[model samples]
Target: MVKVRLWGSLRQAAEGQTEVEVEARTFKELLDRLVETYPGLAPQIARGVSLSLDGVIYREAWFTEIRPESEVVLMPYMTGG
Candidate 1:
């Protein structure tokens, strides 16, 4: 099981719940489950979001390859202007 944590507006969509569990083997799979379970969150995720696994930010697609009991956190992408 993957632990999925949500922040900001995403939290609201999850009924103020901070965490969720998904049956996914990888990050993308986890994301797909999220979109499937929470239809309301789909738009926010589609707009581009950053994900962290077990506290560290996952920057490479490689993170999506390993199947671990992960703690996945989602937040908006940061941009420097």
Candidate 2:
């Protein structure tokens, strides 16, 4: 199980728990697990949310694999004009 930390508005979706545990082999899997664990978070977690693994930002496609002991942070998207 990987430990996932929720931030900002996501904390609300996660029932105000700053941290959660998810079973996953990849970052994508983590999202899938999160949604399954907390159905209410699906829509929010899907909107270009970025992930950080062990405190390092992970880019697209980098989510293909995950470390078993990794700690992930889910952050809302940042949009610019």
Candidate 3:
């Protein structure tokens, strides 16, 4: 299981939990598992969310490999002009 830290607004969607664990070997799997476990997060996830592995943030990187011990953070999708 990969432990993901919920950042900012994501904690509320994750049932107020700051951290969560899900079985995932890749970035896509992590998102899938999160929604499956926390239905409240569905809409935001569908709209878009980003994952930070170690220190790098990823958006739409479905195939990115994630280590079980990696520092993972889940947050709202980042946008820039």
TM-score of each: 0.79, 0.84, 0.94
> For residues 10-81, could you state the per-residue lDDT of candidate 3 as single tens digits?
899988999999999998989899999999999999999998889998899999999988999999987798
Q: What is each predicted model's overall lDDT from 0 to 1?
A: 0.74, 0.80, 0.92
RMSD per candidate (Å) reads 2.2, 1.8, 1.0
Error of 2 at 72 (Å): 1.3
Q: lDDT of candidate 2 vs native?
A: 0.80
- After aligning candidate 1 to the native by TM-score, how far in Å is the CA of 79 from where it should be? 2.8
- 2 or 3, which is superior by lDDT? 3
Candidate 3 or 2, higher TM-score: 3
Candidate 2 Cα outliers beyond 4 Å, as residue runs: none
Clashing pairs in 3: none
Over 9-40, each residue of candidate 2 has an lDDT whose tens digit, in order, gives 89998888999988898878888889999987
Predicted candidate 1 versus true structure: per-residue lDDT over 1-81, tens digit per residue: 777778778888766778888888776777788889888778877787778877777643534653456567877666799
